[model samples]
Target: MKISTFISTLALTLLMLIPFNSNAQEFPDLDKSPMDAAAFPSKYDEPKKLIKIIYSRPQLKGRSIWDLAPVGKVWRTGANEAAELTIYTPMLFGDTKIEPGTYTFFMIPGKQEWTAIISKDLNVWGSYFYNEENDVAKVAVPVKNDKNNSIEAFSIVFQETSKGTDMYLGWGHIRLAIPFHKL
Candidate 1:
């Protein structure tokens, strides 16, 4: 009776260990999912210019406006919710002045010059049905490549400077820089 009880206990322990051991294995197929925009923390406060750009993934895959995007094409830029971009203070991009307000961000990716359009419309999806006539400001910015690329997800980073701020968009091997001065 003692030997039989010991065998039963050992069998129960092995049954429990099987599920735990299989859980340790990694599944690459499970890694595909839409990234949460809230994962990127916001740094907004008074006095300083606060620009918050919110993006989402409506589809299974992600959206891109590059070689994935075509030249002379209008991209929704982001998923649902119009890819909202809120500016706290007045800012100047080239000669164009962007007031402190929320606006929908759209992009026209090209081989030579990528056009960044700030539209009065703040709510939209993919730019499949974007109206260029509603653009508040359109600025042409050059795209450059970085040697040491590490950023995997699409991101926008702001670097404060003495004059103003430098907004950078990093994705894959491309890094585009845009300077803005306070108005």
Candidate 2:
């Protein structure tokens, strides 16, 4: 109501709108992995690249990862945040047809193999409320495990192929690969 009071309130509100200087004091986890995406050129002879996957990398830290991605379990794919697959064009992701958009990535880990999933749901966390019906595709990824060869962290990457790309997941001495073809 008063002029002085109104000016004081406006000044306070403006200060709050300014960016906080908290970045210096805030500490970050050294163990926290970074988010990365793997993109490849399209097979249609297009100049631009397509088929991108964004995911976080989680280290094993000598802990058993099988507990989270145990046999017959529906895996969230990685840690922290759910993995995301973004395509610039329509393509078959793990045998499931998907249009140009982003998708949630999940998995079903088995002793012999792993099934990668492209889900219609977005921003899912830790496989919570994972619906089989929401999946766009559940394609089997060939798996190979070596006791001597240990992978330190969970990773999602792709290898160039004539048709499209061969997506690979490597973690804890285990590696799985699946195909994604551009239509």
Candidate 3:
């Protein structure tokens, strides 16, 4: 009986060791444009989150900013999908009050200024389907050049200021800050 039981155990172990032709999930390689998120009160221990944004970072692989995002055209604000912005509290976007909610972020790039639009649309792939009717808030922010701080990857960061918070977008040598004043 003991010899038979040992043989059975050995056989089970060998079977487990043998690789089978099962349908294993194959995860693809890393994304060329990786998804990222930024939030106000950036610390993890912060109890309240004022605002947050989910976007993709597209690198400038020997491509100019105009190549990826054309001038005087609506951009999804990122690479893969339209940037998603969640406002936790009512905030004033250049006198236009924006309520606490999630919205799609889009931008129409220009040489002097950029029109930042907050739309009611959500889960959109790109600005290809952008509709003007869905825009809830639109603000024209002047483009600032920071030749010293040339950023290769598209990035959005929130910085606390005396007025309120500034959501700054940097790429190449261009920088734009969208102010969110406290209500």
Candidate 4:
């Protein structure tokens, strides 16, 4: 009886030594620049999607837009990763036609304008590996300053137009609209 009691006590002690929830994992904190997506339809349950963009939203955090994205330089167009633009249907950026596929999006911020670039490169981390030779389409989009409302974080939104859709990029006091006409 004593031997059985000792065995039971030892088993209980061993069980206590082992973690009760060994499967529990330690998750990291939220990212400073969170991933976001903007679709043309905007609706969650929309069946057909004309275009979608996956990007990381980076906040200004009291930083200047010129400092964050310097003029005459290629920016990732977001935070960590270069924005990914998925075109469901063929669209025209200027005279250049972009086919239905996923492409890396980049930008060259300027004082009065910004050049939007859609490259063939995939899985790119940032503009560090951006190659101009892989550019599928490039368009010069005029920048508009919003004096009244200054956006803190980088944001992208789509607005329907009679031609197609306007993809607006807003950050700080700068705003740009790249028109993608249906082709």
Candidate 5:
């Protein structure tokens, strides 16, 4: 009887541990889409200061709009949710100060310097349908090729600095960086 009880407790503990493992096997039917705010408990509630950007598959993996993207080509810079890029704190891009808000991110990829554009319009596909007049800010950043092709998932991360913050976008063999100061 003791052996059976021990086995039962062990099984229960293993079952409880599954959800916490990031690499745990997931069932095929389980949906991984972003959940609504109410789905999380009150303890998880906190005002999100950071803007969330989501880039999904197909849109991200296929031919990227760089070098091969054609200089004048309009590209849908990111995926669902309008390829949203957020500024958590006030920042200055180039000589322009950008207030904290969400903006639709777009880029004009070039062999030398890439033009990064943020627009007030946040709902749309690739820049195939872009409007230059909608742009709120535009900054030029240089792109450097990496010897080792490292990044598989296209992503951007912001790092804080004494002056302000550095916005880094990593993908393919390139890393594009933009420095901003507090507005």
Candidate 6:
């Protein structure tokens, strides 16, 4: 009975979250990062779809996102709802092993490196409810700066490297790549 009750409550909570995420888009006109960016899935012409990251893209409308997303803080990894990463196969994310599943993605930004977290918690609006105990894997990745150019909107793009896929989280003028390979 408890299991059934838990499932029902979980379902309702997810339902309520969608509306709040929409409400997050209702920012003032002068506000930067106004677009509640949501990235859809795109498949590469490979064996099958490998990984999918779902998150919103907030643009840097001439204002520095650094004011909103400072160093040494936990970013929701995107706007609105929490960013989610879905792995289709067994793989290695840095030194951590990740099996096929979906998990909430979070990041703690620092001056030199960023800590990437794959958390068990779901349906979270942002880092507001982030719990370290629920983390499945956490690894530090060095920051990559594109000094010559700046990204207007936050984006997640996959680059097929020689070893595996390099997942890049680009925002403002910063980009961090997390490498993952099939086992």
What are the per-model numbers of colliding residue pairs?
2, 1, 0, 0, 3, 2
Ranking of all predicted structures according to lDDT, beginning with the best and ending with the worst? 4, 3, 2, 6, 1, 5
lDDT of 2 by residue, 51-154 (tens): 77777788888787787578888877777677887778788765567888888988889878888888888988778778889888878876888778888878
Go through the candidates in order and give each one's C-alpha lDDT. Answer: 0.67, 0.80, 0.92, 0.93, 0.63, 0.78
lDDT of 4 at 70: 94
lDDT of 5 by residue, 66-155 (tens): 543467555445333446666666767787777888777777777787888878887676666788999888888998888687575555
What are the runs in model 6 whose C-alpha is more than 4 Å off?
1-47
lDDT of 4 by residue, 104-180 (tens): 99999999899999999999998999999999989998999989999988999999999899999999889999999
> What digit string (tens of lDDT, one per residue) describes model 6 on residues 7-96?
999999998877555455654565343333222224543357678877777777776776656677778887878887888778788777
lDDT of 4: 0.93
Each prediction's TM-score against the native? 0.68, 0.77, 0.87, 0.93, 0.64, 0.74
Give the least accurate 10-residue stretch of model 1, judged by summed lDDT: 32-41
lDDT tens digits, residues 106-128, model 1? 77777666788888886676676
Clashing pairs in 3: none
* Cα-based RMSD of candidate 2: 6.6
| Weakest 10 consecutive residues of candidate 5 by summed lDDT | 34-43
Which candidate achieves the best TM-score against the true structure?
4
Q: Which stretches of candidate 2 lie over 4 Å from their true place?
A: 1-27, 42-47, 146-148
Model 3 TM-score is 0.87
